[model samples]
Target: MQSWLDMLREARAQGRRFARVRVVTLPLNDYSRFGVWCSQFTNGAGEDIRYLERGKAAALALPDHDYWLFDSRKLVRMHFDDRDAFLGGEVIEDAAEIVKHNYWRDAAWHHAIRRDDLATEQHLGRV
Candidate 1:
């Protein structure tokens, strides 16, 4: 986590934009709670992180897949194993697919709550 934060810090220092939106289910699990705890530092390093409840995201018809969209031009769709372990990703260069990912990213970002706010709510047992 510190390694990623270091990279993010450097990227922000270089004027690069960094953001993440995590879709979490209600009754947060241990892993999810840990992530929220770590976000305190990452968010402080200039990474704009947000959270959206799974139910809310489902109502919006968002896919349950995760991917990284680079510069609005490239995408690498993530593939996970049955146990939700990271396997690998397929780099997608198709214009249509890239457009879809960009659109989703924009929509999710628009609706997701900031990490700081979510963390506070979670810590207070209101999430």
Candidate 2:
């Protein structure tokens, strides 16, 4: 976690932006709550994290899985098991695929609420 925070800080120093939209469920499972707690540290380190309730995200028809879009150039599709354990990631450099991920990123970012704002509004940080 320290390494991740350091990376985020370094990226910010280099004027690079790091952002993510976390889709969370209504009931807030233990894992989701833990993620919310962890986001505070990451957010402080310069990552722009946002939260979107599952229902709202469903309307956007975002991918059922997770991914990382870097600089609107490369896409890393994340794979997980049925139990939600991380398996691995597939790096995709195809222009068309990257473009699609970029569009998803934009749509999610537009509808998601900033981490701090959502925490305050939903009293999530208290969890």
Candidate 3:
């Protein structure tokens, strides 16, 4: 747990100095399996993530604020404490790649659209 906190502190420092902070939103349910959350952010070489684990949860940020949640339906997304900060971040215009999706069929995890950042909680359909 201490190491996880350290990584987050480092990520925050990086966020401030290099803008590595990526904020996203996801639908979360307490009853759902936690492994789904762990696999998302854990893609990077780190201990907080489970890498390929299928049904676990990972605390992306400290204080259990935001998370990467996965549902039994194979839907996964990152969650941010503040939707405004996330949607309006520089990742939209700067990141080399970006992905976005809605609970829709045609989209199916649409990727390569930097403009996807514009879709915030306000734009999201009813949960």
Structural similarity to truth (TM-score) of each candidate: 0.92, 0.91, 0.19
**For each candidate, what is the lDDT?**
0.86, 0.88, 0.28
Best by lDDT: 2
Model 1 has an lDDT value of 0.86
Model 1 residue-pair collision total: 0
After superposing candidate 3, which stretches have Cα over 4 Å from the reference?
A: 16-98, 102-127
Q: TM-score for model 3?
A: 0.19
Worst 10 residues of 3 by lDDT: 49-58
What tens-digit string does per-residue lDDT give for candidate 1 at 81-125? 999999999999899989998888888888899877887777733
- Which 10-residue window in model 2 sums to the lowest lDDT? 118-127
Task: Give the clash count for model 2.
Answer: 0
Ordered by lDDT, highest first, the candidates read 2, 1, 3
**Can you write out model 2's per-residue Cα lDDT over 1-127, one digit (the tens) per residue?**
9999999999899999999999989777888778888899998999988988888889989887899988889899999999989999999988898998899889999999887777777677544
Off by over 4 Å in 2: none
CA lDDT for candidate 2: 0.88
Q: What clash pairs does model 3 have?
A: 34-56, 34-57, 35-55, 35-56, 35-57, 36-56
